[model samples]
Target: MTVPPPPWRRAPSPRKRAEKPLLSPELVVRTALDILAAEGIRAVSMRRVAQQLETGPASLYAYVSNKEELDELMLDAVLGEIPCPEPDPEHWDEQVKEQVRRQVRAMMTYPGIAKVAWNTPIPVTPNALRQGEAMLAFLRAGGLDRKQAAFAGDALSMYAKAFAYEASGWTFGEYDPAHMAERERRMADYVQSLPAGAFPNLARIGQFFNAGTSADRMEFALETFVAGLRAVVRA
Candidate 1:
């Protein structure tokens, strides 16, 4: 017995191909961070990261379970950049303020980075927990009660993140081009132009409102916070 061939059988056509690079957790994270830096959080997604890596989002799942996990890792990566200094009770207020300065400086290095961290439960990640421990240790050394030490630590860390988040708003290029100086000028002008009788208080001190550079403003705030903590803890 012999098989017969169909009269109109056609050969299959080739389909489009996609680049498939070897995937790894670090590579995936690094690519996602690159997107975060080049674009912004809004532009990041599993698919977007995969596309950058010449693969599919499904591949990313092997590393980060979801976007939430990715966000955590991203935050941890940033926190890892900060160094935890030794706790010194002798000058606890000064030591704590120095740590605040370092943390704030670190947060400011990456645009929109604080958004991933602010208000999130104290991170259980290694570097983040180390920060928490260091903050609490210094505060306790300053003679504060356990409750006070915890509150002080949270307050300082949150304030730094909040400050960085707000600053990032104006520095994100296309979103808002007005730097702090431009904003200062605008506010001063607006206040000066206001009808004098209605805003007498604002009119008098309007010129002094936004007088300093970013670093100067941060220093002023950090000093005030540290001073307040010193008074509160009676250290």
Candidate 2:
């Protein structure tokens, strides 16, 4: 029979492992956002987040339902950064423009997040709902009736999402001034080269193709949309 080691010669006991913090929805969202910021949205997934959290993927399900729900939560979190101002009756149009600008800016912070906003059919998340309500208030202050305000709000949301998505495509890394200039020059040349008889308007107006910056175009669009609303106001 083998003899046991003496007390002092005995091997040291295993130390108790440190406990991990409990999982929560907020933590999961934050982790996902972190992943999104580091590597574009495509890098974020339930399994990826769970790996980061040092837990099983099933553990994340208890907090976030699925990747789609996670995306919705992320979009809501981005929108929450935009401040909702009190509807100013006199400056309602300006307020609308400012809010839309803020929304675009917020979405631009994380690459590809704007596409989520664009694809989401009906976002019932808290921040998304708040943004919609605030937009309606602004539209109403501009003298739009209930139905008018509702339709305008929907249109404005679509515009903002589309704008953000497009801007992000250029903003993320593809924005090159010299390249854009060369491309525009080529486009203008191609348009002008077309037979005037076949494309009269395009050949004639092609000279104005590169006249304005994106910012200028956005401002003009906003002005046109807000000004057009006055015509639709209750008679």
How far residue 224's Cα lies from its native spot in candidate 2, in Å, is 0.7
Candidate whose lDDT is highest: 2
User: What does candidate 2 score on TM?
Assistant: 0.79
**What does candidate 2's lDDT look like per residue over 4-109, in tens digits?**
8997896978998998879999889889988887777778899999999999999899999999999999998888888999999999989988888888788878
- Each candidate structure's TM-score, on Cα atoms with residue i matched to residue i, is 0.78, 0.79
Q: In model 2, how large is the Cα lDDT of residue 185?
A: 86
lDDT score of residue 90 within candidate 2: 90
- In model 2, residue pairs whose N, Cα or C atoms come closer than 3 Å (at least 3 residues apart or on different chains), thus clashing, are none
Name the regions of candidate 1 deviating beyond 4 angstroms: 1-22, 178-190, 204-212
Local distance difference test scores for all models: 0.79, 0.84
Best by TM-score: 2
- Looking at candidate 1, the ten consecutive residues that score lowest on lDDT are 169-178
Looking at model 1, residue 121 earns an lDDT score of: 71
